[model samples]
Target: MSAFVHPDEIRSRFSAALSAMYRAEVPQYGELLALVSEVNSRVLKADPTGAERLAAAGELARLSEERHGAIRVGTADELATIARAFAVMGMAPVSYYNLAPAGVPVHSTAFRPVEPAALARNPFRVFCSLLRLELIEDEALRAEAAAALARRDIFTPCARTLIETAETAGGLDEDQADRFVSELLETFRWHAQATVSAQTYERLVAAHRLIADVVSFKGPHINHLTPRTLDIDAAQAAMPERGITPKETIEGPPARACPILLRQTSFKALEEAIAFPSGDAVVAGVHTARFGEIEQRGCALTPTGRALYDTALATRDFAALPDDWTALRRNGLAWFRYRATPQGLAARAETADLEDLIALGHVVAEPITYEDFLPVSAAGIFQSNLGAEARGTAYAVDPAKADFEQALGRLVLDEMALYQAEQDASVAATLKALGLTTATA
Candidate 1:
């Protein structure tokens, strides 16, 4: 049996490998890192409190200095293949989210280590596979590409060997691990090099770039990663001073210290040069591919909090309400409430009424932690990083009816049953430790 890998160690190893993959694919990514460092420095020097909302300046220097990669696949089969490949790196599909019907173009998923500890250790991730709309005329291209992607397995025999060896061993011995990592990096580098002549490859690349050029992007090379920031207003104000012009901005609920889930705006994408078959040409362009996002994380609200969130979203009352997020934290009204102790006594000890709780010395409200990404914010970031403008939306799908579950099931090759079992076990362990009953009382 292979030795188990510590989750934190896995996080560290995976983050390094993924970052290398990104740099290899996007050389300009190095510039993005420098920009992030600059921004982090400025934010820390100016507003020390703001920096603490998510992480400390030094920690942000490490964790916040991350880049996420994005890709788009046409079908579930393609999605599955990519998922398996990422899994070899210790990633998993956490959420089933769809942005297809949203006004901005494209639909996709994010792959990463979902455990909160794993995220905290290193949240390096990819917003993998943004599927584009297939217009009637584009069906031929989509079909051919889909067929080709399904038939062609990107993970080679040797590549799979190294990956499986690494994964099953929970991580290779230092030398073997390093060798596998090298091989893995070489695989992606090889693709970027080998793609020169493959017609299928060219078609896919063109189609991928087309979405960036015409649909969602205004030009070419849309951003691969979009992050959620803690302060959109501050980030916006600070950008121009650093020579970055705000691409655009949007309104969210009146902000307070509490991190809102997602509010994003970014500086316009800078121009770049590309090589084409005809000749080398510089594309005078604007890219909506990169953006700055800020969020106020609320407590991991219980079902009640989610209901309140839904009510807030529906009424669009977050903006109109006089209650600041801090006020919510002060009161028991809008955050998650739970007992930290193993016994249920902590929950039971709280006074029943809010006023009574206040009088009875109960700590009714606690600030919710926000570490997860937001979808609307994600779509907004996607909109900002575009090479082309977004087409107007005609309709919104009832999420209940959307076939993303099955579609996604087809896209990933992992056994959901096994994944689910692992999740159940994790949950049961937590409940048992907390002295909660799993069976109906």
Candidate 2:
């Protein structure tokens, strides 16, 4: 019998295969390839071992090609439909992120399944969206859009069948998978036909073709197959050096190395020639679909760490930002106790807040990990890159809480009860397998 490939390996293969398919559909993905290579080289030089923790250097480079991609949808039905498509790519909806919380000024949710093993192999991820378009509207135009969406079927019969079969068996065979990809492309191509004008439609088609051909043909989009810079200010300043026009900067906190969770800004999407008007006609306009994005990464803090960070932000003077508040945190000394089990929480509860909390107090503060994304930052980048755009309503939403284990069970399609039983059995089996215990507990 074949050796049992670890779950990590399985996830790696899944990401790789899907990335290749996406590249085939989007062709102009060269920029992504180049950007990732640059980031990898820098990461290697800075800390080889650290970079290898989440992924090996070789895997990071490969996943860079498949990186991640973003998509926008209008409704729950559309969101669920796309979720089915992602399953074929071996992805699951792991976390629900509220875009509005990051100050994007809109109501949006992002789903990401960053499986540790898959990430280790190649951190390919997709950020798909379902916008609350109705809330912020031109009522008449929105009515028209709603009608159009109602009339359309986002997935074809073949695609739907493939999704259903795959959901049952966990995946598709080679032949069925190929057919599903072809049918999905065809469906999207058909949808592109509904743009404002033939020229607009053709432009959209070309853009999708570029993404499909350049990025996914080689595999599903690598974690995100695009240029990612650690320093946006420097990248923006240097854009003219590479003959690329720099877009406006999305302002962020001016800390030297703080992990500004998700501050993204991009150049306007430029135009390219596309055949339209039913004949071999050319359209002259820039496409704002592609843009440059940069991010600053920081320590991943525990929940306590995040809460502490928020409190600091609210209480600290704006001028001090992170610097001035260092003293306050140190003097107050309110840090997290790492082990968060019931016993741990109870033990740590005795030392509440900064004034009474101290390091020797047996409490270790978890680093404040980034929990918010700058949506305006994201949209600014999106808007900067595109020529034409649409507006949508924004609303405040109480964030939803997700228990991680439940997400994992859903992603793997295993019953929670079964998984727990298997885990128990495994523990006992390992003891016996190692001859540390008898068959009977």
Top TM-score prediction, candidate number: 1
Give lDDT: candidate 2, residue 15.
45
Error of 2 at 260 (Å): 5.8
Tens digits of per-residue lDDT for model 1, 294-386: 332333333344456557877877643324654554343443322223233344543233334334443222343433345566665555555
Candidate closest to the true structure, highest lDDT: 1
> What C-alpha lDDT do the candidate models reach, one value each?
0.47, 0.42
lDDT of 2 by residue, 1-441 (tens): 223333333335544554454445444334433544565567557876655632422334443433445655544565666677665665566444445443232233344334433444544455554444433334654454455455556667888897787677666665666666666554333111222334333432333322221111111112222344554565555555545555656444444444434444444443433322344553333222434344543333334443555555556534433432244234332221121223333453443332233333422233222222334445544434433322232345554323222322343232223223433454344333333332221
Q: What would the TM-score be for candidate 2 when compared with the true structure? A: 0.58
The per-prediction CA RMSD against the true structure, in angstroms, equals 7.2, 10.1
Candidate 2, number of clashes: 60
Q: TM-score per candidate, in order? A: 0.65, 0.58
Once superposed on the true structure, which residue ranges of model 2 sit more than 4 Å away at CA?
1-29, 46-66, 94-106, 181-192, 196-238, 250-260, 263-265, 272-287, 292-296, 307-376, 386-441
